[model samples]
Target chain A: MSSHQAVREGAKQVVRLLEKFPEEKFKYLVSFKATQLERFSRIAGIPLPKKLATEVPGENKTSINEIKDIVNRTSGPLGLQKDMLRKMQAAIPHDQFTESAMKDQITALSNLVNNKYKNYYDVGDKLYKPAGNPEYYQRIIDDIQGKKKENILAGLRTVFMGR
Target chain B: MLKCTARKSSLNTVTKLYGINAAKTYNYNPVSLYSTTNKNLQADQKKQTELEFDTHGSPIVRGQKSTIPEYKLPKWKEALGEYVIKTFGLDMDKIRAGPVAGSYYYSICKEQGLQYENEPLSDSAKFFYEDLKLPKTFSQWFQITALHEWMLFVRMRAMPFKYGRNYQQKLVDKTFSDIEMRLFDEMNIHSGRIVDQYSKDFNSQLKGAVFAYDVGFYTDDTTLATAVWRNLFGGRKNIDYTHLDAVVKYIRSQLYVMSRMSDREFALGKFKFVPTKEKINKLSAQEEEEMKQKIIKKYEELDKSGLLLPSDKSNLSYDN
Candidate 1:
C-alpha cells in the first residue's frame, strides 16, 4: 500500500481500538502520564512516534485558564467570589456538590422557605421537608462556604501579609 | 389607473395584459389632459367669483409644502407581479437573506468596534478597546470588526451553499462600501488613489485573516488564539494572557450558541452576539429539546397564519 493509504489504515485501526476500549482500561490511560508511557515503551524496546514527545505550549492550559478567567469576570457582576461561581458545564456529568449546584440549591431552598438565609432552620416551614437529614444539606453548604471563605482570606493574606 | 393602462397599451403592442381594447383607450398624455381641464376649471371659477371681487389676494399658506400624489399598483397587479417573478423560478429567499445577512449582520459586527470622536464608547466597544486594552486607532477598529465578521462567516458557512455564497458576497460588498464612506468622511482622505490603496491593503489583510481563522476553527483553541493574537492584537509582545484567554472564550461561546441555532432562525437574522459580561452555560439536553419544540411551534403557527409573503418564505429548517 502507498504511505497515504498506510496512514489511513493506521488511523482506522486506532479508531477501532478506541471503540473497544473498556471503561476500566480507559481509567488507567487517564491517570497515565506521558513520562510513564515513555518509560513503558522503552522497557518494551519499541520506538515511539516523534509527535508523541512534542509539547505544545498552552495546549492543556487554555481550558483551565478559560474557565478561571470566565468565572473571575462573571463573579464581579454577580457579587460572588471567583471560587464560588460554578459554571455548571453541560459537557460534564452533573455533580450536585459543585459550586453551581450549591448555588441553585440555595436559591431554590431560599424561595421555598421564604427566608433570605440559605440554612436549615429557615427551612423549618411546613412546606419544606428534608429527604434524608436537613443538617446534612446544611453541612455541605457550610463546608463549601467555609472553605471558599478561607480561600478568599488566604488570597488576601498573601497580598497584605508579606513573606 | 385608466391612464396607466392607456399609456402601456399605446406604448407597447405586447401589453395585452393591460386591456383588450387598445384603440378605444385615449392615447393623450395624462399630465397635459389634466392641465387643460384645470385651466378650464379656473377660468369658470374666475368668472363665478367676479361678482365678489375683493382687494386681498389669495391667502399665503405657511409651512405647508406641496404634496405630490404617489401611484400604487392595484392588489391584483401586485399579486400578478409576484406571480410572474415566481413563475420564472427566481430565488426569493436568497434575495431576502442578502439584506438580513449582509446589511444587518455587518451592522452588528461593525458596532462591536465602532467608535466616534468626542463620544463615550458603547458597552461592547469598551470591552474590546478599554478592557481588552487594544489601541483606539482606525486600523485597530478594522481588526476588531474583521474578527467579528469572521465569526459570523463561520455560521454563514453552515447555511445552504448558494444562499450562503450570496450572503457572503453581500456582506463583503457592504464592508467595502462602509470602508470607502469612512475613508472619505471620517479619515478625510479626499484623494481617490490613496483610498483605493488603503482599501486594497485592508482587503488583502481580511483575506489572510479569514484563512487563518478558518484553520484555527477547524484545528484547536491554541491555533485560534494564535490567530487572534496575530491579527487582532497585531502580534505585540506586551499582550496580556488574560485578554487573549477571554477573547478565545468569547469566540467559543459565540460559536457554541450559533451552532445550536437553526438555519431558518439564523437566515432571518435572529442571531445576536453573547455579550462579554454574560456567561453562556451549556443547555441541558432537555432544555435543548424544549427549545427545538418551541421553534417548531413558532414557525408552524406563522406558516398556518399565511402572513409571510412568498419572498419571506424559506426552505431551511426551524427545528434543526
Candidate 2:
C-alpha cells in the first residue's frame, strides 16, 4: 500500500479508538487522545495523518462488548497478543476494573495531561509551571487581587457616569 | 516537528559526552544475573560488591562529591522528632503520603536508570544501560523512571480515591523537582530560562508518555513495547527483542507484587522493587487467600485496640 493510504488507515484506527469515549462527557479527553495517537503513530513507525492534528468528535456509542474486547485486541506492528489482561483483571479488585472506574481514570488522565492541580487553580497555565508550586500559588493570589482592584475601578467609573 | 529534531540533536551531544566505548566499562554478564538456580553465587556476588548510597539513597557516582550538603541535625533529635510525631499524631490534617511517595517511592523509580557524567554504573543501572544496551543519557534515565512510575500508578489507582490521588501527586511533584535540581546541580545549566524551558519540555514529555503507557498497559505488550521503544530507546533501528522482553517482564513482576499488598501497607511505603536478577512466580489460589486473610486479621487487631487516632485512621482496605 502507498504511504498516503497507510496514513489514512492509521487515522481511521485512531478515530475508532476515540469513538469509544462519549464526546459530550470527554470533550477535552478525545482531543488529548488525538495528539497521543499521533505520538503513538510516530513511535510505532506508523505514518502520521495530517487531518487528525486537531480535535475529532466521537460518537460515544461503544457497546459493552467492545469495551470487553479491548482486553483481547492486538496492536502495533508486532501484533503481539496481551493474553495476561484477563489475569490482570482478576488480580485487581472488582471495584477498580469497572466501567465507572475506567471513566474516573479517563478524567484523571486528561487532568494530568492538562497539568491541573488538585488544590490550586490553574494560574500557571501561561507560565508553564505546575499549579502545585509555591510560585503558582503566589500567581493565583496576585491574579485575584488584581481582579478586585479592576472591579473597584469599574464601580467608581459607573458612579461618576451616574452623576 | 522542531522539538523532535531538537531532541535528536541533543542525543547526538549525549553520545559524544558518553563515548561509544562507555558500554564496555561495566563488564557484568546479564545472563549470569538472570540465573535463578545460582542463588548462592548471586548472594556471594552481591556481598562482594558493596554499593554505598548517600543520605538521599541515591547511588554515589565514583566517590564524587555530593551536590547538596549533608544535614547537621543530631541523630538523636531526628529520631526523637519522628517518635513524637508518630506517638502524638501531631500532623492531623494530611496523611504522610508526601514523604513516603516523594522520597521513598521516587528513589525506587529514579535509581532504575540513573547515571552521571564520567561515573561508571554499578548495579541496576549497569543492567539497564549496559546489558540491555539502552543509551546512557539524561533523557533516557527520565524514560526509565517514567516507566516505573507508571507501574506504581497502576497500583496507586487501586487505592482509595482521595489518598491514591494524593500519592500520585506527590510522586509527580517530586519527579520534576528532582529533575530540575539534577539539571542545575549535576548538569550545571546555569541559565534560568534554559532550565525553565527544559522543565516545560519534560512536563509535556511526561504527560504524553504517561498517557501512551496507560494505553499500552490496558492493551497489549506490542503497544507497551512501542511506547518503550519510542520513549526509552528513542525509536532507533536495530532493536533487540530480548531486551524488550526483559523490560515487559520487569514491569509485570513489579505490578504483581504490588497487587497483593494491602492498602495500609502500600500507603505506609512498604512496597519495594523486585530486583531484575530475581524471578517472580505467580501465587497459588490457596496462598493468595491466606495472604488476604492474614492482612485482614492484622489490621482488624490494630483497629480493635483503639490505638489509632482520628488523624491516623484510614478507611482504605487491608484486604481485597
Candidate 3:
C-alpha cells in the first residue's frame, strides 16, 4: 500500500481500539488516537476520516458492548449500579433487545467476566443510550427526511426548470 | 378844637396897641408864652404834613466793607503738601531720597513748583516705591526695574514649552509614550519616527501657549483657551493623532455604508477635511510661496473675467 493508505488504515485501527475500551480506558485511548491521527495526517497530507475519530452509533458494536459491560459491573457500587441499569434499560431498543433478555445476558456475563472487566459495562451503558432510544432515533429520522425533502425540491427546481 | 389857657399877666403889654382891645389879655410874661407858642406850633406842624424824608443813609451799610477783611492766598507748596497728605496719606519722610524726593523737597522749601504739583502720586507707582518697601539704594531700585522689564520680555517671547502647555503637556507626554507601544500595530511607522514626530509637533504647537496667554491678557477669548488646551494635550503628539485615526476610520466606514446605499450619493457627497492651524503652519516654505502665487494668479484671473470686486485687488500682495 501507499504511505497515505497506510496512515489511513492506522487511524482506523486506533478508532477500533477505542471502541473496545471502557469509558475511562477509552478516554486515554482517544487521546492516543488523536496524537496518532495528527502524525498520520502530517505524513498523508490530509485530515483523518471523521468516522475514525467520532463515536458512530449502531455501526460501532464493540463500543456498545463495552459500555454495557461497564454498567453491569458497576451496579453494586452505591446506587450507581441501579442508575446505570436504568440508563441502559432506557437506552437499548426494546423490540431488538428486550430489557429482561439483556438483564439475563448481563447476569450470565457477570459470572464469566473478571471484576476488572466489569467497568466496561458502565461505559457501554453511556455510549448506547442515544443510539438505542426511540426518541433519539425518531429525531434523527425526522432530520434525514427533512433534508431529503429539501434536496428533492432543489433538484426539481434546478433540473426540471434548468435554473 | 384847640384848648388854651391864657394868663392875665400878658394883658398889660398889648393894652396900648389897640384901644378897642385895651381890655384884652395881651400882656405877656415872655417865658410862659414862648413855651406855649412853641407847643402850639409843633401841634400844627404834626397835623399839616402828609409825607416825611431823610437826607442821611444807614450806618450798617456804611460799615459793610470794613467788617470782613480780604483773604491772602496760601503758599502753593504748602497747599500742595496738604493736598498730597489728604489724597494719598503718603508719609513724605520715607520718599525723601535722591532726585525725585529732593526735587519735591526743594519745591516745598523754595515754593517754586506749580500750584497743583503737590497732588498725590499714582497708586501703582506709589505702591511700587513705598508699599512694596523697595530697597532705598539706587542699585536695588534698578534691579527691581530690570526684573519688571525681564518679565515683560518673557511675556512677549514665543518659546515652546519642553513638554506641553500647563496641565496638558504632562497628559500629552504620557499619552504619547502609551501610544508608542501600539504605533507599530496600528500605523506601520517606526517607533523612533513616531516618537520624534510627537516630540517635534508637541514643541511646535506649544508655542501657541504664548498666544493663549496673550489672548487671555487682552480679549479674554475662549477660542484661544481651547487652543491652549489643544497645544498641551490635543496636538499631534497627544490624543489628536489617535482621534484623527478614529475619525479617518469612521469616515472610511461611513463612505462604505453610503456607497452601499447609493453610488450617486457617494459620488456627489463631500467629506470635511479641517486641517489644523498647526498643520497649515507646517506646510513647506515652498508650498506657502506656491500658495501666494496661486492667490495672485486667481486674482488676475478674476480681474480678466471682470469678476473681481472693486478694491479687492488693490492690496493683494501676499504676507509671508
What are the lDDT figures for the candidates, one per model?
0.58, 0.58, 0.31
Tell me each candidate's TM-score.
0.51, 0.51, 0.13
B48: Cα error in model 2, Å: 23
Clashes of 3: 21
| Candidate 3: Cα lDDT at B274 | 21
Local accuracy of candidate 1 as per-residue lDDT tens digits, B17-47: 1233543443333344346558875554343
Across B1-320, the per-residue lDDT of candidate 2 in tens digits comes to 00011111212322211234433543445566668998986765554333222234323222334322242557787678667766886642235777678767887898888776545675889878877777677888988898889888767766655566688889999898888878887788999899989999888888877766655454445455556656676654334434554666566567667767777788878898987788777777799899889889999998889986454666666775
Model 3 spans with C-alpha error above 4 angstroms: A1-163, B1-281, B304-307, B311-316
- Model 3 chain A lDDT-worst window of ten: A120-129
| Model 3 Cα lDDT, one tens digit per residue, A1-163 | 4544654444344334323322211121123234333443444355555765454343646664567677567746445567776765554323222334333333322322222212211212112122112132233334433542345775586455332
Give each candidate's interface RMSD in Å.
Answer: 21.5, 17.0, 39.4
Q: Candidate 2, residues A64-123: lDDT per residue as tens digits?
A: 356547834645213434565554444333321233433333443333322222112211
CAPRI-wise, candidate 2 is incorrect
lDDT of 3 by residue, B1-320 (tens): 11122222323221222223422434423354336548875554333321122112211112333212242345885567566765775533222222121222121211111111223433333433343333233223323222222212221121112111211222234333433533443345676875677545634443334333333222212222222223322221111112222222222232222212211111111111221211212335596468657755655676589653231222212221
* Rank order (by TM-score, best first): 2, 1, 3
Question: Each candidate's DockQ score against the native complex?
Answer: 0.01, 0.03, 0.00
TM-score winner between 2 and 3, please give it: 2
